[model samples]
Target: MVKEIKLLIKKRQSYIKEFWSYINWGIIVCSWAGVVIHIFRQTELKKLSNSLENVKGLKPISLTFFAYLDSLLTYLTELKKLSNSLENVKGLKPISLTFFAYLDSLLTYLLSFCCFFGTIKILRLLRINRRLSLLTLTLKKSAKQLLGFFLMFVVIFVAFNSLFYLLYHSYVRHYSSWLDTALTCFQMSSRHLSTIPDLKKIDTFIAAMSLFLFILLVVFMLTNMFVSIIVENFNIVRREPFNHENEVELIHFTIDKIRQWLSMSTRKRKIQTKTDPITEFPEKIDELMLAVDKLYGNTKR
Candidate 1:
């Protein structure tokens, strides 16, 4: 029991040492900090804007009367101070907006990374499940081939993006810029066929041919090649013997023990048996049917 406790502590220490765990924790901390900072800044900004608007609505008072002169002077003095304060507040508007913009962008980026890294961490946690780990295993095994395919894909994609941009830059808005053209091409390959209509407006024949070629080369060909590579690697990996069954067995055992402790019955699988009638001999079909009928008749009697 002491050895078991020590081993558990060592395992936990190793888990804590993992860099991805640190990344996830860092993201959580930063995200919470960003949320708090955003709320505080937003409240302060709104208060400043509202105060400026309220102060701007205040009209100037006259100090023409002698009896009311003292009160008017004091009111005018306070108004002047408020006006000066408004000037300083006005200066902060642009700076505050810019800061808020930057903060919002930073928070968005952090959240995106948090989601991505969180998924990776979940996969790490669930790596014991072979079905869930198949994708990672396939990628690991086929990394070289996938890298090669990616290089080739990039070359082809760049060529097409360049071609599309050069050819339809003036005619199609999607191809107005190199970056837009590249995005449009990716969308096109992913079945976003919206650009085809725009291209058709330019020249129907050219648009038709471009669509056919792009679909054939990128969508069908490249996609199938990628799928084939992954599937081949998956098959190779799946055929190999697994050594993690012991861990899975242990998990099952623990679950079963818990269920027993709760006095819950374990699920029992019912085995179904089936018998198929033979019909191999076509010439003996009538005899077989007669025999079946006779058997049924005897059972009925």
Candidate 2:
């Protein structure tokens, strides 16, 4: 019994530690408030940091403040220096094709993580701009879901690209190159296909059949599948905020049930009370309520 209590206490301490780690990470994230960190080499941070002093505008801010800002800026520059190794992360600079796409994905994730967890929490604490805070949170959550949907689309689009490439290569002459076939498949999958009049050159039966199936897959099957996944997962994300109340109720219900079970045990009242309590999670309120009824008796007719 004492061992179980020790384990629970250790587990709880670990969780608390993780929560505070998140807050400290948030602080580090907010420390870079005004300075920008460029990704994908969009702009050179070195040039900005070096020239901050020489830029001519009557510097209204105090030198002490600017010097302190430069100190924080040095930490960022050191971090950027570490990123020199990522020169080849997004494929060769010559060709735009990314070597592996997940590197690009990591950008969105870090951005959302910092903004949603760090900046959003800080803004909420300020209580000055609730609407903006909510909007930031909504966009962060939605972007995660949208990124999943996009990756799914990429997989399906690749499969269909290969299928259509084969079909066009074997039976059709209108598509002059494999790249053309891929672009066509992507266009159809994205529902951005131009009018059918563009395909007037292809008048074969196989071509027509393939086109029919392409439209059917894009419009009828894949579109609905993607939409359903997005809607379902979006609801799951929306439900997360209410889970705290459910968890609290579950804790209370479990305690009461355990108390009753211990009091009714025949092994000896004190002996039962001394035993370690088991924790149970009710996935739904109805399940918890039903368990309570079974234990305490329900008055419903």
Candidate 3:
């Protein structure tokens, strides 16, 4: 039984090693391919823009592209309804879906370049630890990647805001008339908000609070999801014995082993005896000693 168990552990380890080996190669190839594709895409976009200039007022082409974009956007919005089901689709795990969703968000913002490079770095790091599970490593990598992205986001956000303010002061001041007209148009377009005398203050506060609450809710949901996955994986690792074959089998085997060891120890203790010879032979020894004394006294007499 011990030999069989050892064999199974060896087999499992071998499988894990092979799986990681394949994964490492796949990651390397995919990363290189992604870089090549990105470069090709940029070149293509440049060529496309040059081609667009030669075509006078490609309104039809622009309309078709916009039409497709609108359809795609509508489809994606509707797909939200199936988010729960899509998450558990056949061969697709929740973590995998979450990862793709993160990628999709990054791609939409043209920030996938950061993710691509981050993934390559993560893969290289992973190659150093073959014993680490892919899911565990991926979760860790995803967290670090997200942190990097958040930092980038902060830097970009601050830089853009600063640039915008600088441009606003330098350029917009020179177009004060245009700015005034634009502000007036915006105010006129949004006159309904100002015109509501009775509900104006109430609406303003409610609107502001509602927006704040919505933002908070979104942040809470995302945080919950991230924490939940980490906790779930941690729990799985905690409850599972590293060398256990199956969880159920491991539990039964552990119980049996404990029971057998207890029984053997109990039996061994029962067979062990410490006898007192004086208690069992007290008469024989006393008579022999009395006879010896009598013989000695008779000799003396």
Q: Identify the candidate with maximal TM-score.
A: 1
Model 2 misplaced regions, further than 4 Å: 1-156, 167-174, 242-301
Task: Report the lDDT tens digits of candidate 3 across residue range 63-159.
Answer: 1232123245664654464354344345433322233333334333343444554565555444333344445544653565557555754554344
What is candidate 2's lDDT per residue for 101-129, written digit by digit as tens?
A: 23233444455566667654555443233
Order of all candidates by TM-score, from best down to worst? 1, 2, 3
Q: Which residue pairs in model 1 clash with each other?
A: none
Question: For model 1, how does the per-residue alpha-carbon lDDT over 187-216 read when each residue is reduced to its tens digit?
Answer: 998898888778878888877877788789
Weakest ten-residue segment in model 2 by summed lDDT: 92-101
- lDDT for model 2 comes to 0.51
Q: Please name the candidate that would achieve the greatest lDDT relative to the true structure.
A: 1
What TM-score number comes out for model 1?
Answer: 0.56
C-alpha TM-scores of all predictions: 0.56, 0.32, 0.23
Clashes of each: 0, 0, 0
